[model samples]
Target: MKDSFYKYFNCNNKEELYLKLKQNSIDTHKLGKYLKFNQEKENKKIVIRGQNKLFDYLKNNIPDRDEVQIIMFNSNMEVLSDNKFPINTQFKDILDKSYVETANHVILLSHENEYNKLLRLEMDFKLFGYKIIDRIELDKNLELDSKNGIGNCQFTEEDIINGKNKNFKEEKKKINSKELHEFMDYYAKNELLGLNIKDDRKKIKEILKIANQEKSQEYFGLITYNKDQNITNIETSLFKGGIREAKIDPIIITPFLLHQDTDGLIIFHNHPSGSISPSQGDIQVTETIEKMAMRFYKNVEDHFIIGKNKTFSFREEFLLSNYSYERSSNKELSISEKEINLKEPVKNKIKSKEITKEKSTRNRLRSRGQER
Candidate 1:
């Protein structure tokens, strides 16, 4: 490494090294052709020893394929100009600070399908485009794995009596502005959710769309269920938190699970930033709740991450296989609904009353070769 340029010249920082190279003739000193600065795997210095690493690898070394390149600058890692990117589903949690709090490596994300050409124009028409989705870092003195929603988050009079180091914090898990307005709305007249916002993809998506007015913070939600997977409750205020994190501690919801109507749970939270992609924190909390759910001979049904326009379903995207789908504790066939004359009545497959247009008009339109 004596062949290094900085070693030959008695220079310190990159500025000095640059000035020296321009002033002196490199051919006169006869430096090595294969030139590179001093770089070691675990060097303690933030930059460099002989000189500073003004030439960071990621900033300088990305491939020069303009077709697939995206340039971004950041003052702090908290916010970015970009909100979403197509990345591997497995590494979704990597975006959450709890997973890899302050990573010092480049995060390279790619497309799941090569022919995912639906957004060809929106993605700058680069079918093979690449995006670096880095971690969301906290402000201040760079707290390691910072701004988390775990461990004794809320303060109480009990903490004061016990002389705990906790301070008074806002109780996040409560019905707030959204629900208050809803309660004051037509629901006061028992107009219970006039639309079907209670099951499947539509349920999570529509509910979030209505409740996602607060884009500045996150709201951890829970959909409680009985042993048979029948939902008992769905509340948004399970725990509200600032952007980038929210508490999903199983202890907070343990009482809910103990209830006779609630043996299972489905946990979720909103990405106030409008990205439906599940972060590492989301997965970790889901796993944490699932582990505790197993104790009650149950499992979390799904985790629905609410975005601005979409909802990311853990059960749908990752698949139901990773979870305990089959419950051996299910009741015997002797207790079937048919045996007790409690069988549900089958109605017309299509309920025309719910349809806004009259069936006669729709049929007439269809008869007239309506394209729609």
Candidate 2:
């Protein structure tokens, strides 16, 4: 029968066998799965030299006898079959025939020395329209060492022994918080010039500390926001020591805003003297950004001043209301406004906290009417 099988295919190598199977319309990978299912239902045993947890699991789970045929391979190229072939049968000698011609499933039990050879053999078996149920690795003593398979068929010795099937949904919920912290720490150290904190307020405070550590000078930061209100990107502009003022040019940042397709922006600069007050220059720059953003149908959401230990939000202080239609005008705005506008009560509360401190720095930046 084996001789007849060999003559039918007339193949010289594994690749030729694969092509032959393909031409014959045999879905080898699928056939492998089907054979595995049949083997499980029948509880067929294709034992190696020694027993282990994986063997025990298989013995307990599979049925006593079934129509499915299982083939086991060892380092010596020994073949355990219903019809006895020679004891030292070379794999190449059997390659001329298709595994599917003789068996329903192929279960390779490989020792450490035989693993690579068995892997190649398994690949050939798969190509020749054979369903491979298990490709298990055994130690030198032939005990259960590792279980390997592709896709859903993959399992571990522990999983089989404990009868534990994988739960993909629950597995996904396991967040690697350590990875997140590491990434943030690296970004704060290497990417930014200022301090890094997880909390927004603490982050601003740390930035203030770093900016004023040795000498006090203004540092400007631009935060770009997407339509979803998430801070998508951040950039900084540094000034010389003892320079209390910095200018922000919309033209310089226009390309970036357009590239990011930013829907809103927050422009912040630190006060080296720890003054939590927006200067006239700061207000003027905010208005300028607001005007330019309106032209592109974008928003100047907030302008923040990071001071000694405190931070001031131009939006929270109602200084930005005039540039936002949803805040200043009573009429209904678009869905985009719904995303950018703060609630009326929140605006009122912010307006109640009157601006108590201010600084004088002049720049002729005017505001255009807020676009709906």
Candidate 3:
């Protein structure tokens, strides 16, 4: 029997297949969770090397001892589920129930001949965004059969012992904090700042009011690193109107990347006004983060203000010792403090009508609004 057809559709034995997955993890620089396969095609099917629920599920559902068909899905490429279905039924019905509707790709694992037929059959399903095997590479280890069908074999301990020499250590170079920070800076300025913090309708309405006024509350993030500092990371729990309260602080914006070992970090946020000033709120937030960093034994090296222009950092004005210039560089205008002229305060007018009420009422509102 031609096992190559099966190996082609699926991977080697469980351990070997897992090793291949590990290799893919190193090659693609992705988490193992992203690796997955479609077991319905040959020379391209995902082989579940170990016996687990997924393997059992495949075996139980596909009683065709000689030729078994399977399908699987994953977050990064890891098999989340290895579901099997009857070949007699249409594949679409199986997919609709087995995989998430948002799946970007579909895998097919079967014998070489069957895969060719599937390629032809899959054209009709393409309209539904069902991306069939984007690739079809041969598996030399699994020999092809001129007739019969593909062989779906199980692994024994001997297979792993045999393939030991093929294994190699993963070469991962350590990145310095500066490089990590630079990477974060680029990603945040280009992609991250655009993300709207998840907010409810009431919160969104409040932000919209500020946004409409051209002075929308801005967001700021700080990434600090120091050789001696123990606090290597700090983040604000939530943005204004983002549902953080005295009992529950807002969830800090998740960093796109974290390199705790290198003691490096990068942070950024949106400028609703398109300006870059460190507002009173911004300063308070920074101070809070700085304090948190100190508690964690990490340094608060720089606070970044991301907007239409480039990202601004607190380190730029460290020499100036001028909070006003730092705030201006961030495109944030101070509303509470008097202007440079000192004759009048900057137009830091409270935009919210509720905030404009009596001092007692405003105090109550402010108290309720402050992040815990």
lDDT against the true structure, per candidate, is 0.42, 0.48, 0.36
TM-score of each: 0.36, 0.34, 0.24
RMSD in Å for candidate 3, one decimal?
A: 19.1
Cα lDDT over the full model 1 = 0.42
- Candidate 1 vs candidate 2, lDDT winner: 2
Q: How displaced is residue 255 in candidate 1, in Å?
A: 0.8
The better-scoring model by lDDT among 1 and 3 is 1
Model 1 misplaced regions, further than 4 Å:
1-201, 319-321, 325-372
Candidate 1 lDDT over 199-314, as tens digits, reads: 44454444444444334688786666654444556666678788877876667888876776665666767788878766545656776777776666666767877675466676
Task: List, residue by residue over 1-372, the lDDT tens digit for candidate 2.
Answer: 112221223544334544554455343333223223332422344544333533543432321111111354444323334221232345556644324233445565543555566577678778766666676554433244445432122334553333332222223224343332222223333333322222354444343333332224666767665655555666655332345777665678677557645666667777777676665566667777777767666677667776644567776666664444332342334434543464344444433443322111111122222331
Superposed model 2: Cα runs more than 4 Å off: 1-215, 238-242, 323-372
Segments in model 3 whose C-alpha atoms lie over 4 Å from true places: 1-93, 97-107, 111-227, 230-287, 291-298, 301-372
Residue 343 of model 3 has an lDDT of 16
Q: After superposition, how far is residue 210 of candidate 1 from its true place, in Å?
A: 2.3
Highest TM-score: give the candidate number.
Answer: 1
- lDDT, candidate 2, equals 0.48
Instruction: Give per-residue CA lDDT, model 3, range 1-372, as digits (tens).
Output: 212311431443334434554466443222132211111111243434332533343332322312324344443443434343444456566556566544544544333445554454456446656555332212333322322233334433343233221211111122232332232233223322222222222222222222112213443343333333322343431343321111213235223223444232333345654555544455455555544443333334445554333334444434111222121133322323232333112223322322465677878888989955
Q: Sort all candidates by lDDT, best to worst.
A: 2, 1, 3
Model 2 weakest lDDT span, ten residues long: 357-366
Between candidates 2 and 3, the TM-score winner? 2
